[model samples]
Target: MKARTDTKEKIMELGTDLVESIGYPSLSYQQISSQLGIKNAAVHYHFPSKESLGLEILNTAIGSFEKMISNISSLGLWEQLDTFFKSYRKHLESNNKICLIGASASDYQELPESMQAAASEYLVLVKGWFVELLREGREEGVFHFKGEPKHKAAVIVSALAGGLQHARLVGNLHYDEIVEQLVEDLKP
Candidate 1:
């Protein structure tokens, strides 16, 4: 796997920043070009279309979380789970908006297959991580489950994501509180 050139990485990094700040629906290549102090052609040279750029940006953001998830130690899975949820809550606090998954899923069906695939892959990864963690906890007798851990892990991931969306919808939901409550419930 060849590393991306600095300029190409810069372009993608800028694209992610712009999308997070302005939003994907309102993002413009012209604005990105202007922000980079380059001609629109430069932006197009790196990304042929806005959708392609959006996908790259989304992938980059997801890659960050993947790195963090991969870094989690199996020796401390419950602690790792708490850290993951805490990090997620911090993201919500900082962004003060729905996450990429939440926002993208809202209109996911209308998006290109690549974008939809990206969103689907994220949820799959989250569920996969939860399954691993939950299984570890159950093996240690620190977690009790009425059903299969894998199935419950999927349900928990979906519920946590749904909770975030609900918090965003209700306007007064506290993300930290929700996350803390989730952590408590997950504890043995």
Candidate 2:
């Protein structure tokens, strides 16, 4: 049982890496099996289909982001925003990859219905977190932006996702500068 769990986890981890490095449509069971030195049948035994693997990957990424947000929930508004930017920078600098949902979105139409729904849910989860944070920041006089918190949250989320893709081309330093400007603009 432990071995089976480990194999399943290995598949998910490598699958995620492949999807992030490339894209979901390009990830193959053969690639995962080759990387893990396992038969393709083993991969099939665990995932059975690409849709299943994609759904699991989306869920794992979403859960991970939720945990990160929860962990920083008690921090001051400014600190929470700082940590959020830093979290994105961490991924950008380390992997040069956009968020899983962002990457999946490029191939959204090609993905299975379940995977598409999972990706949509992931975006909602992140956007909802940002809305709450922006509202809190506004109430605390820490954020000064023109529209409703919901609209502002959407802009922030879109900017970060766009910035990550841009960063992959122009470099993380440029991305940092963009985020810094965003933070400054948010200041009350």
Candidate 3:
């Protein structure tokens, strides 16, 4: 029983790394199996399909983001925003990979319906988190943005996600400048 659980986890972990480094469309049970020294049939037994594994990866990322959001409630408005920026930077710097949803979005039309829905849900989750944070920041007089919190949230999320991609290509120093300017512009 423990061995079964361990194998499943190994598949999930390596699947996620592959998807993040490459992309969902390029991932395969064969690749995972080769990396883990397991037969491709073993991966099939656990995941059944690529879409199933992709969905699980999306859910795991979403769950982790949700926990991060929950923990930020105790932080100051500026601190919360800064923390978000730093987290995004950390993700890119550590792995040189874009956020899973962002990477999946590039091949969104090619993805299975279930995987597409999971990616959409992940975007909505991040946008919703930003909306709440922006609204709180406004109420607290820490944010001086001129638009609706929802709109502002969309811009911020887009900028960070897009910026990560740009940074991946150009270099982290340039990305840092752009992000620093973004955070600066949001100040009251």
What are the RMSDs of all candidates, in order?
3.5, 1.2, 1.3
* Per-model TM-score on C-alpha atoms: 0.78, 0.95, 0.94
The local distance difference test score of model 1 is 0.71
Q: What residue pairs are clashing in model 1?
A: none
Model 3, span 10-107: residue lDDT tens: 99999888887788889988899999999999999889989899999999999989999889879888888888888888757666778786788887
Q: For each candidate in the order shown, give its overall lDDT on alpha carbons.
A: 0.71, 0.88, 0.86
Q: Residue 168 in candidate 1 has what lDDT?
A: 63
Q: Model 2: which ten-residue window has the lowest total lDDT?
A: 86-95
Candidate 2 displacement at residue 98 in angstroms: 1.3
All candidates in order of TM-score, best leading: 2, 3, 1
Clashes of each: 0, 0, 0
Candidate 2 regions exceeding 4 Å error are none
Candidate 1 lands at a TM-score of 0.78
Candidate rank order under lDDT? 2, 3, 1
Tens-place lDDT per residue, model 1, 116-172, is: 898788777777878877887888877666678789877666666666666665642
